[model samples]
Target: MAYVITKLCLNCKDIACTQVCPVDCIYEYKGDDPSIPKEMLLIDPDECIDCNACVPECPWEAIFEESEVPDIFKDDIELNARIVGKERFVPKRNPDDPIPTPEQIAANKEKWGYKP
Candidate 1:
């Protein structure tokens, strides 16, 4: 099964996962919603090789195996699948950016109303 990028990534699109993705299945969703603090990044489940390459790369702990996706973020499964053909999106993950520290990641998740 494909790995899913969840709400923990709402304000943190570090792109670390994309940097190591062998197939580049990750995408950047361009939504005009004013509440989104940053550009949203999603994994194209259909294209994901299920190689587990993107899982450890996400500092926000945003990516999870499709079956392991927590219930709080469960809606994202359909969200990821449905957005593919219906929204404005692009393959925009390409930079060797610095990975976030544990503290930074925790803070980001908190900003998005998540704590763990």
Candidate 2:
């Protein structure tokens, strides 16, 4: 199964995952928020070789396997796929870019408005 990015990543926006992504499959748009949604990370299942490279990379523990995820997090399965394919809820951020600063995180909250 492929990895999925869940709600726990909503405001965290940590780039730790990107650092360890050996395949460059984990990606973001770099401060552009093109979809006008929260600046969250997404794994490209199509590109992901299921190497499990990113699962341990996340400090917030937002990434998971489809079956390993809790029921409440099942929806993230499709959400991750959708974001990967359509960039539907994806906010633009570069995969190689640095994580958002604390101040930028706060500003992102204002722009994306995730639930606490």
Candidate 3:
């Protein structure tokens, strides 16, 4: 089964998991407007190799194996598939891109009016 990224990633937006993914399956949906707060990222089920490398890399513990996903986060599995299927998913930032620090994440949250 593929891995799914959950709501815990909403404001966290840490790229650690994405950077560790052997396949470029993680994606985000920031919509057409660059000014908008980016939504959570998702794993492309079709592309993911089911490798667990990303699990330990996620600082927020947002990624989960499909079968192991908690009941509360089960919807995220479908969400990932739906977003990818609709071609609304944007590829994650390059692995070489610098990850945002805690201070930067906080500032971004404030700038985007995101509570978490």
Candidate 4:
């Protein structure tokens, strides 16, 4: 099975995991406006190679194997697939790109009302 991105990534949006994915299956939902901050990143199940390379790269520990996804966040599997199906997925930023700064993360957390 493929990996899944859970709600823990909502505001954190850390791209380290994306950088390590060999298949470039990781994507961020840009919504309708590219200028707006993305709500979360997603792993395209169809494209993922089950490499598990992205598991440890997440600073927020949001990635999990599809079958191992925690019950609380189990719905993320369907969310990921639905978003991908809607063509809302976009390739991750360049691996050499920098991740969000602490300030940015904090702002996003506030904007999204993310408790974690």
Model 1 per-residue lDDT tens digits across residues 3-108: 8888888757767777788987787756665432235577778888899988877777898899998877888787676445444444545466667788888787
Q: What is the full ranking by TM-score, best candidate first? A: 1, 4, 3, 2
lDDT for residue 25 in candidate 2, whole number 0-100: 71
Top TM-score model: 1
Which has the better lDDT: candidate 3, or candidate 4? Answer: 4
Q: Indicate the TM-score of model 2.
A: 0.64
Candidate ranking under lDDT, highest first, comes to: 1, 4, 3, 2
Residue 112 of candidate 4: its Cα lDDT?
41
In model 4, the clashing pairs are: none
What C-alpha lDDT values do all the predictions have?
0.73, 0.64, 0.70, 0.73
Clashes of each: 0, 7, 0, 0
Give per-residue CA lDDT, model 3, range 1-116, as digits (tens). Answer: 79888766776675677767877788775556443235678788999998899888876566789998877767778877765554444455555656666676566545544453
Question: What C-alpha RMSD separates each model from the true structure?
Answer: 3.3, 6.8, 6.1, 5.0
* Model 1 alpha-carbon drift over 4 Å, by segment: 30-38, 86-98, 111-116
lDDT of 3 at 93: 51
lDDT of 2 by residue, 32-111 (tens): 44543346777777877777877776655677877777666677777666545443332333567575555764564345
* Higher-scoring candidate on lDDT, 1 or 2: 1
